[model samples]
Target: MRAVVFAYHNVGVRCIQVLLARGVDIALVVTHQDNPAETIWFDSVAALCAEHGIAVTTPEDPASAELDQQVRAIAPDFIFSFYYRHMLPVGLLAHARVGAFNMHGSLLPKYRGRVPINWAVLHGEQVTGATLHEMLAKPDAGAIIAQTSVPILPDDTAFQVFGKVVVAAEQTLWNVLPEMLAGRIPRLPNDLSKGSYFGGRKAEDGRIDWQQPAQAIYNLHRAVAPPYPGAFTVLGATTYVIGAARMARRTFADLPAGLAVVDNSIFGVGNDGQAIAIRTLTANGNTVTPEQLQQALIDNPH
Candidate 1:
């Protein structure tokens, strides 16, 4: 198969590597144009492709005349969109005879927009899946070719889940390639009635609200937490940031929820009698102990 890989980030590199391993002859790589200090994992993939004498091109835009002309020249049989930053234009989507596909991190059409894994985790979903689908005009609203579920462990961060999903993605694509090439791939229409959309997250979205019930606020904790942005709260005026967290149960009924300290952990109590322990936190760029955390809260209480 003469394939075109549209990729960005670490997952994008894996997609290239996996396709290469499976003996799929890549026609060329279509990636986001690298910018100053922009560390998207395109370098290694570009280098690998170069070493193997496969073409690599960074399209200035998905619909650019130059890019369109280049792709037409390569005449790829299959197009795989993996973590590509730009939206694929309909003109490009229709280029490949075997069709273009995207690797989505959520079970669509439930979470149909960007960063679906984070949404799934924030909503406390125990199971989140990767969906491989046709690249339609709308994001993640295409017909499904295959999906494989990934576990959301209590200690799991977005980083961990993303890693798991990327690995799952490679396996799913390689397995589906043959059927897809032979024109035997089945596509199930996405139920638009059940789709939900989320926009790009902001810095303010990470601000933690202490007044909320611990469990209710658990999503806020992980939603903007790092390798993302990490949830934060303004203690008086100094913004205190929180990283890893878990919903913990307090056998003692008297303990107050969302409280700053108990047993060297900053905890918040929930209505249903559970305490959320926020471990691994940074305050004003300093790692602090539970006692220090209490002191910070007091000194900066807003």
Candidate 2:
């Protein structure tokens, strides 16, 4: 069956690749230009599509008339959106002769908005799933077509969780695509009232608050830690990225919530009276050991 795919990021690329391997003809691929501001370590959907000789279009607007004409010309049997950046307008949603579905990073109804993986880690969710759902006018409010979950370990970084999600997304699509193409896909409504929606996170949002609980701070650290952006804290004029940390059993009662050096290791006292052992620290654009951070703090105690 011929399909029109709107995709970006690693998960998107993988989904497209799997479909191509299954011998599904891709009529058109709509993707986005890479963001120059962020460091990209994931596979590019555009590049992958080009390598397969699929027609790829990078559009700034999902609702543009030019894209409409292209979709109409192809008259695809299926339209799949995998981590595509923008919302598809109702006009395009109707273009699919068979079905239109979207693959989202989080389980249906929860973490509906952008960066669901990071938000799940930040919120300390023990389980999060990848969802493939019916594409509706409202973003991620679509009925669930298929879903598969992965566990979130206590110490799992957002990047690690993201890796699991990528795999989950691919498997979900693989399992459901046959039924979807046959017009036998099931629809389970996502109760909007029971779910939560979160906004997109920025680098500035990674700023850590020492006064929070130790576990909270640790969650923040792993939630935005590298390959995304490191959670940061400022001491004097120096800003340190909290690369790695663990919640300590003991709390320093006398120490105020901020920087605390104990036994040649760096710690941050939380307002909850607990301590977080700062394992690896990034200072002056370099990752350093705890002892090195101790020395830096002593040398520049401003």
TM-score of each: 0.88, 0.94
List ranges where model 2 is wrong by over 4 Å: 288-302
Specify the poorest-scoring 10-residue window by lDDT in model 1: 37-46
What is the C-alpha local distance difference test score of each model? Answer: 0.76, 0.87
lDDT of 1 by residue, 113-139 (tens): 888888887787787777899888888
Candidate 1 residue pairs in backbone clash: 224-230, 235-300, 236-300, 236-301, 236-302, 257-269, 258-268, 258-269
TM-score of 1: 0.88
**CA-RMSD of model 1:** 2.7
Question: Candidate 1: misplaced stretches above 4 Å?
Answer: 33-44, 47-51, 251-259, 269-273
